[model samples]
Target chain A: MAETPIRFGILGCAHIAQTVSRAICLSPNSTLYAVGSRSFEKAKKFSEANGFPPSAKIYGSYEALLDDPDVDVVYVPLPTSLHLRWVVLAAEKKKHVLLEKPVALNVAELDEMIKACEVNGVQFMDGTMWMHHPRTTKMEEIIYDPERFGNIKTVHSIFSYGGGDDFLRNNIRVKPDLDGLGALGDAGWYCIRAILWAAEYELPKTVTALREPVLNEAGVILACGSSLQWEDGKTATFHCSFLANLAMDITVLGTTGTLHVHDFVIPHEENTASFLAAAKTGYWELVTGMSAIPSQHVITTDLPQEVYMVTEFSRLVKSIKDGGSKPEGKWPSISRKTQLVVDAVKASIENGFEPVQVRV
Target chain B: MAETPIRFGILGCAHIAQTVSRAICLSPNSTLYAVGSRSFEKAKKFSEANGFPPSAKIYGSYEALLDDPDVDVVYVPLPTSLHLRWVVLAAEKKKHVLLEKPVALNVAELDEMIKACEVNGVQFMDGTMWMHHPRTTKMEEIIYDPERFGNIKTVHSIFSYGGGDDFLRNNIRVKPDLDGLGALGDAGWYCIRAILWAAEYELPKTVTALREPVLNEAGVILACGSSLQWEDGKTATFHCSFLANLAMDITVLGTTGTLHVHDFVIPHEENTASFLAAAKTGYWELVTGMSAIPSQHVITTDLPQEVYMVTEFSRLVKSIKDGGSKPEGKWPSISRKTQLVVDAVKASIENGFEPVQVRV
Candidate 1:
């Protein structure tokens, strides 16, 4: 084992930062190194409340944390509107980025962040924690199995939460200047990522926005959906909202099999996650019911998925630090593809729900 | 109790009739009274093979069964193209109609059939057996309970079954003049009905067909989908296909709760059905996972859902016969509403995937 842990510095006191803070503490290869907020006193309070070690630094500004030589990685949990500026600056300071989702306002902004990380030789990975879960790897194995899954024919994903009157009116996500894409960027980001993940990151040929996307008074999307069609004739549809009950579903249907994960964004249990799969299932005699039932597969981990994400990021950062290995290309490649689909969907919604081609 | 059981006369030897035939035998309030086919030998074989009693009649022509005074209900399982002619004739003979769905190729045809039933004082119900499942009632109780489900916001239903090469080329559903609308009228009919049922029979204001529907060479839709928007901002989307794995899903999201039924079309087991419901579910502390997991509720019945459908149809007929009641209006009304949505989806698909207003 390495003597020094990859040090993590948090950029904000955002709600999601608390989760990442716990994960950084749980990861054996990483440590909570610092936290920065606009107010030094607020940063101190947050650090104390979240179990920061005595040696961890506290800074009054994000720039202060970026300038700290001890901070090897910065987990950016700021709003999408602030991601481009902070992430690029952090990369210029040679800090690896494990950025929160809806990484930027648009693909152009995300491209700039990616280039910054590339220029500085720092790793870039989105904070989609579910992708790091062991269950996700198991699901990918089944989806790619030629004998069982066959060719994927259709995919449907939904990620939504009832953002009550308070969040709808007061949250930064609903404000046009804060998270301009609104629910499409917040809840929708996971759905798009799930679709791209199931399709093996092969970009769709065209994406058409579903009609009547619900938008707030500030023209921020409150709820929206889109359909994507691939050149191989595979298709997908996803719905995201801030106005419905909490639901996270990813149902993928291949010609001979199906995969259903009701709580795909987050598992019901932290230690174990499960998914249902049916391969070559059939109907009962006379069609009274199904002949073979779907089998539930459970995957267990020693740590939560967020911890796994931190550990993975720290592993890459360590490789770059001690092993002289180049940064991993898989993480940012998938993130860029997911963001490309998001851009295409937004374009379709803006251009009167027309079909917009997805360009890499 | 009425001394006489409702006698069911089946028209045509369609494969679906085999399931309904078993249902008729299992239903306590009904009996398989007769069968008709274009050939006498075929009618005799169908009657003998499907548990028809020794006294049951076999007719060479459908008109012969319709004219029989002993047949109180005619279960029409003929191809959809023949429904307009045979259903009108059966209703004219004062027979209750347990018609297979889609009840007609279009709502106009369905309206004609409904008028014929009303003029003759005969009850009319479609063969959507899942609606009669005890589990369905339980689901409605939760979805309708104000404290549990709250106001409905969005719904999604998917019903798809993969069709092999032989099925695609040879099935009556693929023949233009036989089933005409193909999978849309077959599988999509169930999806539309489920959406209407969840929304309490309220028709959507606009229906837009998803683009790039897969169609056969004869111009029959093999796979299709649509999005519906209600005037009150309630929305629904459904996908029906003959090119994916068999999947029957109905996921409803209310303001405070969610309801999920994976095998909504047919239960995975003959003796029981289940659904999952989560009310006011929340995230766990630190956002590790769901705070409250959804609980599975199972309902068991001695008879299959198809038998329950037959028993319910017979009860309605017996009410008109024994209780001196007019034919119940509920069945035809819901059937018409389902057909209206089906018609709207079909029109939208035909009209360049435009948003067509549902004219109820």
Candidate 2:
């Protein structure tokens, strides 16, 4: 018997939603069934432009879309401020949630949203597309290999982009009441996630923000960085900015090996991604040169990373819908851990760059 | 008329001397004229094993080598504890000094060495070979190009090696009375120099050591890191360790571009080096991919970087010897700046990781 495809209802038409809509349509187990905006005209316009099939529903209000029993899941790409309201409402209406990152304004709000999903028996997953990339899994295997890489030592990550004058002045990412967290939530989130990923998801004991963070007039972070320390002597640092050139870097140093990836956030090519790894790197007899040059490991996939994200989410949602299985806990657990570190970094910055203890 | 080569006298035969001796022999303008050691047997053995010419003089004592009037330049590879005494003595003896890095135990000692060279009209140059690599010059041009790289934002560097148990127990770098500063001085020197080079040699305003540095029983740093902030908000962070795998990385982020190099300290290959440069990197229409992928810039050279260092140092020495030119102040000035940042990091660590103000 063939399994039924999960039907997705998208809430609002954020810029990111366009990409997610495409991913949903592309995924084998997911179909873009509906889209809802504040008005019927906007929803129809979005659905027409985004290649939604004629059978896809267009709703004037989000409530109407959530009320559709055919919509098994809702991909919420709303701004951070509105996540709590829409995500909880969608969960209460029995729709699984795939929420955008900077998952909430803070952990407290994220906790409430998680609770609502839990109470409604709905699956929750954040949209960190890179997590689904095959290259990430390959990097994980290499870094955690007991012989090749040994125990982790340090990690450094940077995720930044030149947003230019218009973005700095006008984007929702810069508006205090909308995205609010600005570069820290938008870009630094990826860096923090990379560091945590390198550390195998162990929350750091403390996080200390670096000095001289660039903040806009509305007190939103434009650029910032922080150093994290684990109890076992592992250390990590990350920087994120809206002012620097576009960069996505992750450098992980272990006892016996190193891993470097320049485009961890977004692959330069759609079908291929790569990371450089070196094991037991040493110098020549006279220390004139290195004995081992890092070799590149390329991973290829037919589908884009976003489609993978959608397919995985739909799998979890389908298992719960048809197989009588409980929602997968791993997705929300990782999301919570990432948010904890983000909150600690924010606290460190707010406390005049003092070290903030990270409580699990 | 052809120019006469600058005559080079070797100091006590440290392990590094073998490489520099080869470099001296390879440089067209530098000749290995004499060898010196505490014992004549050691000097003779080093010279013979290192392929010195039969006519090269072997001295039983360092003083005898310093007394040789034909020794135009003295290459000092002795331990840090012996640098102040031997470097000053060589300078006073009118031999141009090509000293190894971590230039002195402290700036006070370095100041005395510099003063001696100034008084004796001898050239002073530190043996940081990578500075002479043509790739370094090319990188400098790119980073300083305002249109391509724009204003510098942040720099991160790492130089570390897994020194194993034997090295941790017995290496001079781990000994309190010998190298004293341990990994901080040995590996951290290159990281600091890279940051300064990226910043065009402007010393940072403040340096704060990161927490939980791994130290030996003698309280010498085995692994450590620090963040430096310049007056203009240009920030840099560096980590150096004897506890991690060999890694030499430099990542510089500017408003418009980025530069990345993995093997900045020692090239993976002797004759060629490369760096990745990305200018105006942006995302695709839907932010699924990069619009401009970073391109690798491979640089090749006929002579090894060490040979270039020797050639450059000898060229300056020859100008002083033949053209009656005053010693170039650039080399000593940059070495001093690097030492200043090193001192500040040490102070910050000693003061329980408090921020230490850097003085010019």
Clashing pairs in 1: none
Which tens-of-lDDT digit does each residue in A1-360 have in candidate 2?
A: 766899999999999998898898899999989999998999999999887999999999999999999999999998899999999999999999999999988899999999999999999999999999989999999998979999999999999999999999899999989988889999999999999999989999999998888999999999999999999999999999999998899999999999999999989988999999999988899888888779999998898899999999999998998888999998888889888988998999899888999987
- My TM-score estimates for the predictions, one after another, are 0.99, 0.99
lDDT by residue (A194-234, candidate 1, tens digit) is: 99999998999999999889999989999999989999888
DockQ values per model:
0.79, 0.86
Instruction: Please tell me how candidate 2 rates in CAPRI terms.
Output: high
Reference-based lDDT, residue B231, model 1: 89
User: Listing candidates in order, what is each one's chain A TM-score?
Assistant: 0.98, 0.99
Show where candidate 1 strays beyond 4 Å.
none
Worst 10 residues of 1 chain B by lDDT: B284-293
- Best of the candidates, DockQ: 2
Which 10-residue window in model 2 chain A sums to the lowest lDDT? A284-293
